[model samples]
Target chain A: MDDGISHNNNNNQILCPIKPIRCIVKLGGAAITCKNEIEKMNEESLEKVSSQLRQAMISGLSSVKICGMDWSKRPGNSEASPTVDDFSDQSLLDSDRFIVVHGAGSFGHFQASKSGVHKGGLNQPLVKAGFVATRISVTTLNLEIVRALAREGIPSIGMSPFSCGWLTCERNVASADVSMVAKAIDSGFVPVLHGDAVLDEAQDCTILSGDVIIRHLAAQLKPEYVVFLITVAAHDTTGGMVTKIWEAAMIAKLGIDVYIVKAATDDSLRALRGELKGNNVPEEWLGTVIRLLR
Target chain B: MDDGISHNNNNNQILCPIKPIRCIVKLGGAAITCKNEIEKMNEESLEKVSSQLRQAMISGLSSVKICGMDWSKRPGNSEASPTVDDFSDQSLLDSDRFIVVHGAGSFGHFQASKSGVHKGGLNQPLVKAGFVATRISVTTLNLEIVRALAREGIPSIGMSPFSCGWLTCERNVASADVSMVAKAIDSGFVPVLHGDAVLDEAQDCTILSGDVIIRHLAAQLKPEYVVFLITVAAHDTTGGMVTKIWEAAMIAKLGIDVYIVKAATDDSLRALRGELKGNNVPEEWLGTVIRLLR
Candidate 1:
């Protein structure tokens, strides 16, 4: 079937579709953290998701990356630090062919602010408490996720942005060892990365968003599709319309064809079948925006 | 923590309340033929039984054999057959140091009878259809048990009574290669055996009871206990009382203690814990009987 690759009858070189959509399923933090939203994660639902993914894999889909974000009560501010404790089943992020990155909303935001790190930009002094708490949170979440995946018959390893020696300044991250991620994927395990305040040369450290991590990943992998199962629908009919618009604009700037679809519950089985109807992101558009040199 | 074993500080030779019982649990042919029982098998119940047996093994108990009877119903005898099928999780069976022998109750009991094998004994005059059906039935059930055990993380291997050279004559199994059973137990795997007609030198060929195979096993092993978990309690209190009497008397004659305890539901939980308490031939009387052997 259509594997997003065109073959020339005359020659053997397979022509891959520009921006070949490798599926990156970004599970919004709210999807797993909200009590009501995550209530449907029973055995049957998990089995159904597993079956669907197995089918996708069997269909020659190269790989699938599922990422989750840490949720906090604080909202509408990118500067709010995220932590790993807010998420469950973090091990789902660990796969050789998959890359999982999480947000640090609960683990570091308040700690960083208390250390007076958030007041100044990346140039601000490094707050030891905030840094230690961030590391602890990431390590704890990563361990839990790895154990869970092992129980489910999948072996996974964890990686940290801090361990990679990236400079973190305020809410922005710079100069990450992105090649390690590529190496992890090549080795057949899903590498998990998440939003974190990283050490930066220009600025002391910056907060990175789960969204930005996805963009960086898409640029490197040139995946066939990047599916973001977000908590909010594509159109923010709710009063937070301005925030939605800004989020959409930022994602578009990444030059990746992005589908902004509402998250699906277990009851809505159709979504699992890839039969979602509300919105569509065309492959051609994503190809024009995200340019992959390799 | 109390593993049912007591140690005498003076002599270091382990002292156990329950002597190492090397008894064969001869599963009745009627039990395996029951459909309702097989469906009741689940992970929870299987775990309970397996854990109990694991406890027993940890207690330093040695050699428990589980045997199934091949009791294919005669056309008219279907109503009289037991309604429960084998419910033990093969995985649990694999964990314990045990052996399994099954009966062909539904395999060819009727056809063998029609071919005059049941009456005149297993001779060439018997119809091949019945013999083949019996073999197939036993093979199928054995394989199913093996597969089920594998799923429960238990490694199991299958051995057939017929293939192992169990010969019969005139409905009497006079000889068998019982060494294979010992070898399986010695190697730390549960040996599976079933009841069937076997070649006999004097009687030509004979139909054997699972109970009889177990008796032969007890004589060889001289275990501490002999426990049977049949579909119906040992000896229908009414008509088949003779079978019970003969079993007890023969066991007593062998100079070994015999405990005829009724099993509930073939659920390993009840069987392993010895909780089905309608009747119990206690150790005191059993010891006395063994003394009579001298």
Candidate 2:
């Protein structure tokens, strides 16, 4: 409700369409929740981060926010072999231009690791259960994040990756049918996506990371900025923590600036809001930058 | 999301259930959006409704809330005629027990009326398109309602009725397979359902209402009270405006006390949370109480 919260860094010559700044914000589970707890959400952190995004949106910037579910699931919450995208498409139809995707975190990790679904190339019962559990875990978090955004007055819709995601035989995201996502953004609704259990042509079903989703979207949408928010601080290792980091690098070569907020804070948000000195701010210059190797 | 916001209304003699007090809060389209406009959401009204529900939840009550989208859609939002409920199950895995179902207000009305899908007698091309369009409209508002609840930190998962619903030849809800809803509620998650274009054995497709969803859930779950929040405030036909009345009479036969909040106000929400004295309270006793004629 602040009267003066419009775009502040748009004039930096970041190249793209003539409309609002089409950006993507990624949230890591660690940043938004207590990683050790089951379905635990950090309201203060989430509110601060959401308020920052809200500020950006109000300021004339258009972006999609994705959350990483590194550790947000509780066990015994899944049932049978279930696909993840059953409820995704319709959500895309009416979301604010902000697209979101989150990681499976605790929800799928045990099952995925137990079933060896993450590594792909398996059809064991445990792995099958892992796929089901993974979908449940990620989706559970997706609802949580969606509800959080709803409270924030941001019309952010939840899209299960399996609903629009497809993977290669090698366990990488092959397709995410993001046309609805594109349309949603164009129409001004935030489409929320998350790292989820996706059906892989080769591996049966595999993990699709929020990072991978961002890269694919950057390539497809060709947005001005692909921003990543790692709520949980990693051990100085990027790319490896999330899926398809190398692919994101390839996207950066496509002339898109990939910015990462390793730790989402008021200061970093302010910095992001502050215009870049030029179109090409060095990758290191940006906080938690995820550089696709040139 | 908010650590302290669990259902506080259950401790009182909220009636029936040995578990949490299961209730349904129905939001008429008029209560949350401008019935006249296309895809426009009344944030103020929605906020009021959401806050009240949040209050009830915080007060120790377990319930499923449904939003009515009987008139919440415009045009040009459909793509390639997609089926709703693409991601339905995954969401239910980790949702709060508060179940939600909204009317297909604006989104489905036109196509539904044009194709006569509501009548559910035949299958024609327009009816098919109407099915798609209607699904999109209802889904659109489903996302809106989900977003609203998300903002409130209530992990309300959206469910497409068609995903788990079926209609009989009479065009009424034959089955809604709300097992997932029951599970979510048992697990303390809110399952958000909405009126949608569900498949019919005879009519091909039919319009499902949030009211019907409540009635259906009442039978299977046997919640202590079937509470309906008529946000539209349709005339002064009953308790003030939208709380209790006729539709509830249809549900009272189940031996459940029916409470209606004609409008989303503090008093009504308080009243809904208040204990119902006997098996029957006078109509004027509460905002609007419906007693089935013996």
Candidate 3:
């Protein structure tokens, strides 16, 4: 699989550098939830996505090693090089691993919009109500997704940001302790996260979109690829496809390959395997690839 | 409720201090789990505890304000004092709030003990398996507790430390980001945490008992009171009543009051109310009171 390392600057000195992440899959809320209905989950779509994920894990897609990493060969950087001992192979045990971040389609948007939760005013009663309602809604969806994955024999743990100090200040991510995510990945558990109502330094509270979460995780984990499972159509209170595309571009800027693929299709699997690598649009590939223009 | 404030040295400059935490309730594993059987929940006991918690919340047990604060009058501190603006009333809204930490009795002890997970050797497949198994077992129980709380109309969210960077080095808590717990309390949601496996720097992994979690939180949150819900008898892999009492004494040394009350009794409600204060053991109190010597 070409060592599964992208041609980008991986110069960030991450704490305790582990193996580069293999892939990050985003299950769009529309693909997994009945957006028109209140808090309704499209169980069929969720089941299909879970099954595909199970197949991908069992195929050993995440245990690949990124070789040929030179401390002094990276582009546009001048730093003291480490000794040869630092470059020793730290191979991980054979454990299926990946991360899943889902969105709040119908589950949380209703309560969030009604309470104006994204605006953040703790002094207001409605905002507090909205925040609680939105959390319950999104966390419930996260639980269902974990259950679906568990039914397929996947060890998935729900890791919501709201209660884990993934806070935003002035609507931008101020601080997020990804060490837990790193440890979970290192321990071979599929940590499932989602869009959640988080504490904001400027605004009292705000809805942290799943797209932002994906960008943050990619930057931190430096995954080789990110796959977005797109649904046909749906109502969304956060944003539309344009926002997703913009988020994807931002992630691509970090040198991670981003694929926006149709959900419940063979291309999803192809994207997971890093098999859709072509500059030209191929008829067989059912997704658009976003990457740095090399 | 004596404004629900303790005599503890509140000199620690917490990041953006909100109102003080009212109380921290420890729901013993034996009280809510069938210790003799694997993965069995004592639904009847859970329902009773949940009902009592609901009663406490609806009675406005968490909203008492700690008045009469003069930063200049505090003892044993020679730090610079902040202006009056720093001590401005940051009173939280009248949303019932407290933190709940539960133990893993039969649910997780089997998996953890069988795998010798506390010893921490990530290279060994058994330790890794034990990590995943223990996490799954405890998290499943946390979900049940949240469900029980929700059924009784409590806005409870499961916040497990294993998936949130709550790490221990050499069996002592190295770091715990309590900002999320603070934010949840400020926003009026009851945060439910549990004992589980966490990453260790010295050891590869180890069990983080609920008692240690209580002490860590007590130091950070500085709640007015702490209540330990005790069961008559049970098997515990983490530690038994002795460890719990030791943990309670440790909390008491911090100048905050601690109570060890029998579960399924009205004394639990009394502990939550901070109404059971006496040096002499009252026969009607039905619990042991641990406190610092004046």
Best by DockQ: 3
Per-residue accuracy of model 3 over A1-294 as CA lDDT, tens digit each? 132222221111234327767788999998898888777889898988987887776565344332211111112545343332332343433435588999987788876876677889866644655566577678778877876775554657678886555878777776676767777777677888999988886787899999898888887788878999988675445689889998999889888889998888998877876676545446777788899987
Regions of candidate 3 where Cα sits further than 4 Å from its true position: A1-16, A36-44, A57-97, A150-155, A234-237, A278-282, B1-16, B57-97, B150-155, B234-237, B278-283
Residue B38 in candidate 2, Cα distance off native in Å: 2.4
Off by over 4 Å in 2: A1-294, B1-21, B60-97, B121-123, B231-246, B277-286, B292-294
Those runs of model 1 whose alpha carbons end farther than 4 Å from true positions after fitting are A1-294, B1-21, B35-96, B120-126, B233-241, B265-294
Model 2, TM vs. native:
0.45
Can you write out model 2's per-residue Cα lDDT over A177-223, one digit (the tens) per residue? 45445533443446677877555555556676677677666655666
- Candidate 2 lDDT over residue span B1-294, tens digit each: 121122121111112222544567677666776766555677787888887776666544345333111111114432221112322222222222355556654444554565566766332433433444455556667767765675454545565555332344466665444433443354344667777665565655567667777777776566667666665444421123333354577678877777666557755575456455365354455466675655
Clashing pairs for predicted structure model 3, backbone only: none
Identify the candidate with maximal TM-score.
3
Each prediction's fraction of true contacts recovered: 0.00, 0.00, 0.11
Q: What is the interface RMSD of each candidate, in Å?
A: 30.6, 20.0, 16.0
Sort the candidates on lDDT, descending order. 3, 2, 1
What does candidate 1's lDDT look like per residue over A1-294, in tens digits? 122122222112222322233455454443323223211222332333334433333243335322212111112434332222322223233232544454442333333444443333322212322333333343343433433332232323345554433343334443344544453344333455555544443444445556656665554465544555445424321123354334434444455444444444432223323333224323332211222122
Ten-residue stretch with the least lDDT total in model 1 chain B: B65-74
Computed on alpha carbons, the lDDT of every model, listed in order, comes to 0.40, 0.52, 0.72
